[model samples]
Target: MLQATLRFAQTAYASTKRLFSNLFFEDALGVETNRPVALKDLGLAHSDRVDYDPSPWLALRRILPRNEVGPDDVFADFGCGKGRVLVQAAGYPFRRLIGIELSPELHAVAGANLDRSLPPARRADVELVNKDVLDYAIPDDITVAYFYNPFAGAIFANVIDRLAASVRSRPRALRIIYVNPVEEAAVLAAGAKLTREVRGLRPGKNWSLRKSIRMYTLAPPPC
Candidate 1:
């Protein structure tokens, strides 16, 4: 009983920290983006597609440190719903920040959020693309790709294939940050080599909530 209480306390404390750290971003980060929609609801034929669930605000903070990013790098977020991650990443000094979303509804919300959340300084560097992530042509300059388990099975496979093709054509170093790596096996099959996989939450000693969220870094083989 005592162990369970301590674990609960740790989880609560960590959540509070996540909320406090995300305050610089304009939206209310503490609240979940509980908007729900299935693939069939979106008119997608894929039976394996997962529902929309925004990564917690603290996810970025925990994931970013594993890699060394700078102003020279261009970052793109796949399945960027509501543009929360895009806005948060813009606070960094990346060369450019892009978000690609398939759902017109979510894309519109993301656009509005970006308009309201991003300061004037980041406006020029940000681009919100309202299109299927698979259809969107990745820019050659884009070096980092962020994923929040946007899709799985076929859709996920196609995106990884495109990433591999992009690296083959451009011959540039690429970094992929995948949160909640459900399609990690597909990533490896597509020729990406896993660099790291780390938990997105802090673990409590006793009986903390099982954090299903994981941050992963994978890169295509060098050309």
Candidate 2:
């Protein structure tokens, strides 16, 4: 009980502190870019929440601690809003990092943030594409994919289908890492095989929202 309380306090503190770094993030609501990505656009559907939380992308914090991923891996973040996940994930050892974000404005903000955070000498292989996740091809080289419940179960299902196809084309080298994965897990568990269940990804209890983050491997179907 004490530990959970302490953890929540610390997490809240950290999040608040980071907010001080950028006021737009700290004080603003959603609805950015030319169109779409709007928290209210009926088209964005389930993406309206715009959680924008980066805890799930801390590779060493909760993901790789239980999974077999490494620094040289390739990562793709679907619905990469503001590119925070990609930028945070880059701190790891990935050889190539990519993000697909539909909102041109958010993509530009993410690009700017990445440029500000990462030196030009170190950003040779990281890139973010301004494209819809459904239209973008799932790169065969992406070993790990991330989702933060960015879409409805239906949209997530489509992404899972594409991810599964990519794995079938390559077999055992692919992994799906989902944060705040209640809805996303439905799509993954139905399509992809479970590799491991990670519990420490979300902040400890006594906090406002409770979330589950899981890791799964999309292996080939039975022969």
Candidate 3:
């Protein structure tokens, strides 16, 4: 099913590109010509077809409040694509950072991007793994975890349950930061009660639209 969805998305993206070539070129104002590549050539699986907006990473910085984590803090990004969040997180004072990516191609891309940001000694502190988030086991060492609509509500629910169980087994205050929170209801349904929500994000230079982001720290469900 995941492969099939990726294939479908590949075809759709190609079709959309062809249909919008003028738009793409026009948006760039005739700077460069555009061409379509085969999806397999890009090494993305069907599940990798989903292009999630990376807004949540930026919004997350505001919601996590920076003060919540210390220099020894461990950070994790679920479904990290090309390592945007992982690379950006490296700029902060966190002692360790990890990004989980299901796409091998994306993992390599993110690794390369992260390599560019490293200060030699600190480069070893960041790692990106190519594995499904569902099958992936998060480390007990993580003090901060982030998500950006990596999957549907069902999977989000499972991840939420897993996070709660992880903390219960380990007993440390772990914070979950979600951006572009489309599966928020599912997170709640999984018994991961939200402790806070941050709204409104400044638009990037390319995008004229302003956006709102919500963050939720875990809390025990109301009995």
Which candidate has the highest TM-score of all? Answer: 1
Model 3 regions more than 4 Å off: 1-49, 201-211, 219-223
User: lDDT of model 2 at residue 20?
Assistant: 52
Residues 1-223 of candidate 1: C-alpha lDDT, one tens digit per residue:
9778777877798677556645643335332243556656767635655566676665676667624788788989898877778877887779889998888877887877776766777777889898877678878777888888888888888888888788777776677878767788887776666766556345563222233444334454543
Q: lDDT of all predictions, in order shown?
A: 0.71, 0.65, 0.65
Q: Which stretches of candidate 2 lie over 4 Å from their true place?
A: 1-38, 41-60, 70-72, 188-191, 200-209, 221-223
Once superposed on the true structure, which residue ranges of model 1 sit more than 4 Å away at CA? 1-45, 200-223
Work out the TM-score per prediction: 0.76, 0.71, 0.69
TM match of model 1 to true structure: 0.76
Ranking by TM-score: 1, 2, 3
In the order shown, the candidates' Cα RMSDs to the true structure are 4.4, 6.3, 9.5
Q: Write the residue-wise lDDT of candidate 2 on 1-223 in tens digits.
A: 8888888877887676455534543123221211224544524434434534444334334665524557658988887877666666666778788988776767787787777667686566787898777788778778888877676556677778777777788765677877666665565565666676656423545332335567777667778
Candidate 3: residue 23 Cα off by (Å): 23
Residue pairs of candidate 1 with colliding backbone atoms? none
Task: Please estimate how well model 2 matches the true structure, expressed as its whole-model Cα lDDT.
Answer: 0.65
Clashes of each: 0, 2, 1
**What is the C-alpha lDDT profile of model 3 across 68-87, one tens digit per residue?**
67986899989877666765
